[model samples]
Target: MSSDEEWSSGEDDSQPSKLVRKAREAPFVPIGLAGCLTLVAYGLYKIKDRGNQKLSVHLIHMRVAAQGFVVGAITIGVLYSMYTDYVNPTSSKPKK
Candidate 1:
């Protein structure tokens, strides 16, 4: 008779978690998030070094920079999706 440990070991434990699978499937999302975070951090650093500019102006520019980066990332993700779907789909249906 197989021991409990042996039976359990036979089970497939190598499958990745849902989060890991999703991350692998849509890697751009995490990349975009990281880029947004980096931009925000840089903005904060610049704000600390603000010499003569008003706080409001610095804040506005920072906001624009962060938002612009996120927008660009989203656009790239969309374009990539479109290309994969239309130009080179991974799974195509068989013809009748």
Candidate 2:
């Protein structure tokens, strides 16, 4: 094969390609942080509000807050998954 073709095909140039792959695989930090913060705030608010209510009302709020937290967590998971699978296409697999 021609030298130019060999070089362009990248068989001997693995390091840069590996670096590029690593960069692409990097996790998005900001969105993940936001999601975590949102979940924490929701939990705290639920706790604080629970102390100010009748038992029935408090239970209702707690239920709603639990749902919110779950949704937020799932949203973050889905977004990270999407970023890895489609947007970045090189990110590491999510930890089990």
lDDT of 1 at 38: 93
Stretches off by above 4 angstroms in model 1 are 1-18, 90-96
Q: Candidate 1 local accuracy as lDDT?
A: 0.77
Local distance difference test, each candidate: 0.77, 0.61
Clashing pairs in 2: 25-91
C-alpha RMSD of each candidate structure in angstroms = 8.2, 12.3
Write one digit per residue (lDDT tens) for candidate 2, span 1-96. Answer: 766553356685599887666545543343444555665576566665565567677656655765665666567767878786788875554656
Q: What is model 2's C-alpha RMSD?
A: 12.3
Q: Which residue pairs clash in candidate 1?
A: none
TM per candidate comes to 0.67, 0.42
